[model samples]
Target chain A: MTSLPTHTEKKLGLAIDLDTCVGCQACVTACKGWNDQGYGAPLSDQDPYGAAPSGAFLNRVHSYEITPDQGAAVIVNFPRSCLHCEDAPCVPVCPTGASYKRVEDGIVLVNEDACIGCGLCAWACPYGAREMDGDVGVMKKCTLCVDRIYNEHLPEEDRVPACVRTCPTGARHFGDFADPDSTVSQLAKQRGGYDLMPDLGTRPTNKYLPPRRKDAPDMSAPLAPLLDIQATGFAGWLDKVLGKI
Target chain B: MHPAPSVIVFTVLSGMGFGLLAFLGAGLPAPSGWAAFFHWGLGYSLAVGGLLASTFHLGNPQRFLRAFTQWRSSWLSREAIASVACLLALAPVALSNWLGFGWPRALGLIGAVLALATIFCTAMIYAQLKTIPRWNHWTTPALFVAFAGAGGAILAGQSGAGAVMSALLLALLLAAFRIGDGAFAARAQTLGTATGLGTIGPVQGTVRVFEQPHTSPNYLMREMIYLVARKHVQKLRSVTLIGAGIAPALLLPLTPPSLLGFAVIALVHLTGAFAARWLFFAQAEHVVGLYYGQR
Candidate 1:
């Protein structure tokens, strides 16, 4: 049962735009808020008010200062979650048949009932996608909001993943990637979207549109005139006197 | 990567237990009746006790039986099946030898192979994780089997084979250190690659973490990004080499042939092996740590 499906009916995944993301963490917040009430077990927090607090979260925003070839250090907010990879390494490593990629949609999920909480699936994942719920004693991962996507009761426009729907900057986009012409796929193609650790060969369904480089302002260019000013006034005479020293 | 004590007990205790089983199944110093009772009893106690210890870290220990369902695709599942089958195969031999009915040499031989295979499966669990570059190598499994073999031979009272295997273990330990020392660097996965900045920042200037996701450490950071004190680990490595490898190789041959003598050597070797395994988990650098700006 841990064996991965060779093909999914629909590759439903995310295309995160690094360019527009402002590191607001709204997606992270929205994800946590929605997930606490929906789906499997509640994302439990250990020692919430204590000094050393740690919790299980399906989505997280990590900030980085990357110095590009042509730009000043860019601060890119990377949202970490389950990628729902095509060759998902996390699935087959599960001793219990808890971790699996859906055949209908490419989303990877954990069946809490079956999970032994051994954490091997978490170990096998390269993206740090899965986290073990210490309270429930099961592995929890990004379900891509499987409960919400096809919910007939919800309004049509409010049906995407919580993170994608709540992103103020629209950094997260969700669509059926199995269709090449889908918005997520087109955005990926146009922006040169890439897989995280492609060399690891997970063939991740989610793609990241790289942070676009901005030309760095030359540090010396602005300072040259101030450092090499023409002394032409009484103040300049003071400069001449100081030069002798 | 946290080097959980439960896992340490499981790997060290069970590895030795199975290793001892392999030797016992092979008919080394064949003991029967009450003598066989003590020998196989120790083997089962360690093996079963260690297996029980493994459940301590699990979130859902009650659901452990489900682990047996996925052996076709899971190494962990395969390990569960193999270990149980091995104990069962050797069961007939143990019962027969104890009752003075028969030796069951053929069944014992089959059990011996299964015992080694169980150890192999256990090692493969760690070796398969590409995320931890330090453990993702052939050396991981090789080291596990080597330690098991050396310790098992000694426990079975085969001093000659134990001494030679101990020496080989020392060489393997050194080689493993040499290769594993640079394993993380060899992967060349910087924070740049981890965050998808490498494509734009091809020159690889500097990609430092400006801010972390949370002020407090998260589960991933705590579970996967353990940074053991390098000084303590270096000292422990010396202890492992001397106590487990060199001391066993040199002293096992000279010690008078007696149960107490072999037990002393085996205890020393197991202690050293415990240290080695502790270092193995503590020193490993998981690739996910890169995201948290950890080595």
Candidate 2:
């Protein structure tokens, strides 16, 4: 007889490639749309169409403009979501064990029925992945589209997460990071990717590759006489307003 | 941070409970009949519920006993020890009151001091966490004490306090508000320190949101992005100053010893105190805001 899979043995997770990523937010949109209608209660909004309409989003992208002393403007687009860490801090903090990391497949999920709407998990998380579903009185976050990934009805390739599948720039990738031979692991190794805020020592599964540049730009180029003049027509006025050439 | 509703409820409920018990032990007159029973039962029940709710904040509730070991350096540990001590002190006081010992005045004093100490310890837990700038303040402990006193006084008035004690408690509530304002100033100073800038001076350079460190809101923003309108803060302060402060001060001195007056005072104070506590947590900013490039 074949042995059944145990929680400790199986590992599942995601790896993102920053090298090829063009900063598109396809993954963010896809995650929101998928998680919004999936197994858990929809992310609640205080004022959906009114002023200050803020709601819970499972995934979001942050753009950072890093200006090195002698280099061109480097815009680093960081997509933030649940890292689904092997040592997930959010799990043990939950009093009811509602927030738990699955023994099998290593997926961190929230059991809505058991959640008491306490925001402790939210406080424990350094990533801010989790949010309170105020309407249902429970915490919610990215499940990595657990239901879709394991659905037998779907095609084998389509069984992967909606975010991974929808990513236009191929920035988001899903696989077992535990297995060194997996595509994500190989990519992470090859590109020398780094985790966000590694000092926290959460050992986040998601890795980000720092933006690389080849040569420094020359800022000492001689300026045109028209450009150097402080006063002129429309172009001069625009330059004065923006404080830029 | 997302103030867990259970925790919010727990703190408020327990503050009232411990506060009421402490006040009763502080030489306040004994309440009569069902009112007195509720004063004791509700106070202890809320205290238990608050402690239980706080367990949810821990990574391992089962291993919470280990927390007591760190009392040497940890305010959380001190809070745990103090809370347990308050419970132990209350046991004898409760037993004596039941046995018709005329409300064991000495034990009452002990329980009251312990209860206030627990509240102070609870505030210190947050104040000690250097990461959360909003919590790390001398005012936090004072605020917790005030809330406890206010909540307790309100409950006492409802449970039948004579005009003198009511007036005295009311005065304490006003003193708490003044202390809270001082705490707010401290919080603002600490926030400025966290940003690596001194004081609330105007920005010297053209500040622009060029790029953020992350694409999405991280833990810092989620916990500390507690934005309330300036106008609303002003309005709430005014209401608290009057309802929780001035009204209690004026009415307690004039009102006759009646349950109706007490109930009105209790309800008004409870609402005002809760608002004050909420604002206390919300208005305070953290040092982590510096990472987001916000001053």
Candidate 3:
């Protein structure tokens, strides 16, 4: 059962814009709030207010400062979750049939009932997408908000992953990547979206838009003198009078 | 990469157990009566005990039975299935040997094959992980086989010279694996490749870790970012080579063939195996750590 399906009907995935993400962690909190309450297991905290608190959460944002040669340093906010890879290594490595990919939508999920919590899947995942819920003793990861996305109770417009719905900067976009005309696909094409560690060959469904380059400050314009010698003494009085005029 | 003690014990002990079982099942010297009992006892105990210890690593040990159900793909599942099959096949051989009767040669052959297969499955569990570049290599399996063969030869050998030769060969092979593994450079990916920023320019000059995602250590950091000091690891590596390889190779030849001598050699080898396993896990650098700049 751990063997992936030959093909999924739709490649439902996300397109994350690195250029627009401000790293506010709103998506992280929003994902926690929804998934914790909505469906399946709650993201449990061991010592919520204690000295060393650790718990399981699906979505996490990592802030990185990247310095390129011949340019100023760039701060990149990398939000990571389950990539729902075309060939997910985590799926086949599970001893139990607990970890599997949905044939319909290409969403990788863990069947908590079947999971032995051996932590092999976590090791298999290159992105470190899976985390163990120590309280319940089961592997937990982002389900692409499966519960909310499919719920009829929620308004149509709001029927998306909580992280996507709550992104203030609209950096995260969710859609079927199989459709060439899909908004996600269009964004990916326009921004030249790329995969993280493409050499690993997981063929991650999610794409990251590279950070846009900021134009270097123009140095051709006339420069101002650092110290105004004329303004220091008698010329200072004359300059002050000229400035008033 | 945390070098979980349960896993370390499982790999080392189970490897020796199965390796000895393979040798015994192949009718090595065809021991009679009490000697046969000792062989069967040591082999079964090591194999079963190692399997039991492995369950301790699982968060939900009660679900251990489910692990055997997915042998079609998962190496862990194959390991579980193969372990059971190997034990079952060897049961008859052990029983026949203990009762002073010769078992069918074909039955012993099957058990021997299964035992080796089980060890191979165990090796594949780590060998297949592309995420950990250190573990994802042919040398991982080769090292596992070498360790098992050396340990088993000491326990199962009828002659001192044979045991000495096996241990020496193990030492040589261990050195080869270590040298080869160390010499191999990581060419596939780096911090820039991990972040998809290598396309932009040189990442080292442009990037730095401004802040970690969490205020404290998280599961990913704890599990993947295990950083052992180089000096400490070098000391431990010496301990491993000396205790597991050099000591046993020397002691097995010099000491007279006695239970006490075997016990001393086994102890040293086990310590060496433990150290080697610890380094194996600790040294493995998972690609995920690149995001945190741990690698």
Candidate 4:
């Protein structure tokens, strides 16, 4: 019962544009607000009014500073959440058949009622997408707004996930990757949307478009001695490693 | 890996119990009447106590009954089934030995295999996790079976076999540590691959976390990003090598053939088993820790 579906009918997922994300955390707030009442268990905060306040959140935006050889350091806001992998490791490792991936839309979800809270699923996941709810003792993760996305009451524009809806910069996009014509799929093809930790072979549904090059150096101009910039730092080290591979 | 005391206790105690059961089932130091009662009593206490301790590792332990339903796919479920089967299969033999009924010995033999499997299942729970490269190797299961076999041999008063198993265990433990030290690095999971930023293009300096998502501890940080024992891992590794492996290997061959002698050797071995189990969890490096720029 914990085995993954042979195939999902529709790969419904998000395409997060890192180039425009400002790391305002508005989507995090929106995700928290919607998931608190919309999902299986409400997000709980321990010691919210006291020292060491912590709470469960479906979506979190992390800021990273990227520095290039010859320019200012560029800060990219990376939002971390469940990638809804096709071969989700979390599902097969579940001892109670609590963690499962949907065959219809390919969204990974935890059945709170069946969950024994053994936490093996969380350990199976390399991306740390699943979190054990301290208050409820069941695993919780990004549902991709399963309730809201299919709800008939919500208007067409409002049917998207709360994270996509509240992203002020329009950095988050929602669509089905199953259809080649879908916006998400096209974006993936055009912008090179890639998986997180491709080495693990999870085959994540959600894709992240790399931040566009910050400063464009003119290639047509003749090579000048002063302009001969040798790549250094992490990218140089990375090139050497990739060269080894 | 948080190295919760419940899980550590479960592995150490249950491992020794199952090991003893295996040896007894195989007719090592076969006994009758009062002797059988004493041996079975000790075995069951350790086995049952260790199994019960695992129940505390669960947040909703009452629902652990559901853990049995997914054995076809889950190792933890398989372990639950195996442990129960082993205990049940051995009960009749234990009673037969105690009361001189002379019931079929096949029951004990079946239980022995199951107990060995139970130990393997416990190891697979950690070994199956690819997220932790260090524990994902075959050595994990080998180490588990070794510890149980050595510890069980000591409890059964088979000093020669105990000494031999302990020496093998020592060799495996050292190899596991040596291989494990490079397992994470061999995988090359870095902040670069973690975020896919390292593959994008060259950067000015490096890809680094400018700010974390939250100020306070979250479930991911609490459960996966544990680092309390990182600094003292070298010391703890020594504790495992000396206590669980070396002491038993050297002393078992010299100890007199007596229950009291085995008890002392077993105590020394079990102490090392506890420390080794602790290091198994403490030293495991989860890939999720890369998000926080950790191992």
CA lDDT scores, all candidates in order: 0.88, 0.63, 0.84, 0.89
Clashes of each: 1, 8, 9, 4
Per-candidate interface DockQ score = 0.61, 0.06, 0.63, 0.48
How well does chain A score by TM in each candidate?
0.89, 0.81, 0.90, 0.87
Worst 10 residues of 3 chain A by lDDT: A221-230
In candidate 3, what are the lDDT values of residues B105-174, reduced to their tens digit?
7788898899889889999999899888778877777778767777776777644643554566466546
CAPRI category for model 4: acceptable
RMSD of every candidate to native, in Å, equals 3.6, 11.0, 3.5, 9.4
Candidate 4 error regions (>4 Å): A216-245, B201-205
Identify the leading candidate in terms of DockQ: 3
Candidate 4, DockQ score (0 to 1): 0.48
In Å, residue B20's CA in model 2 sits off its true spot by 2.7
Winner by TM-score between candidate 4 and candidate 1? 1
Runs of candidate 1 with Cα error greater than 4 angstroms are: A69-71, A215-220, A223-245, B201-205
TM-scores, all candidates, are 0.94, 0.60, 0.93, 0.93
Residue A207, model 4: Cα distance from true site in angstroms: 0.5
The true-versus-predicted C-alpha distance at residue A118 of model 3, in Å, is: 0.7
Candidate 4 lDDT over B1-295, as tens digits, reads 7889999998999999999999998878678999999998888899999999988868788898899989988999999999999999999888888999988788889999999999999999999999999999999999999999999999988898899899999999999999999999999888877898866633324688889888877888888777885888888888889888899889988877887889999999988899999889888889998887765
Give the worst 10-residue stretch by lDDT in candidate 1 chain A: A66-75
Q: Candidate 4 i-RMS (Å)?
A: 1.7
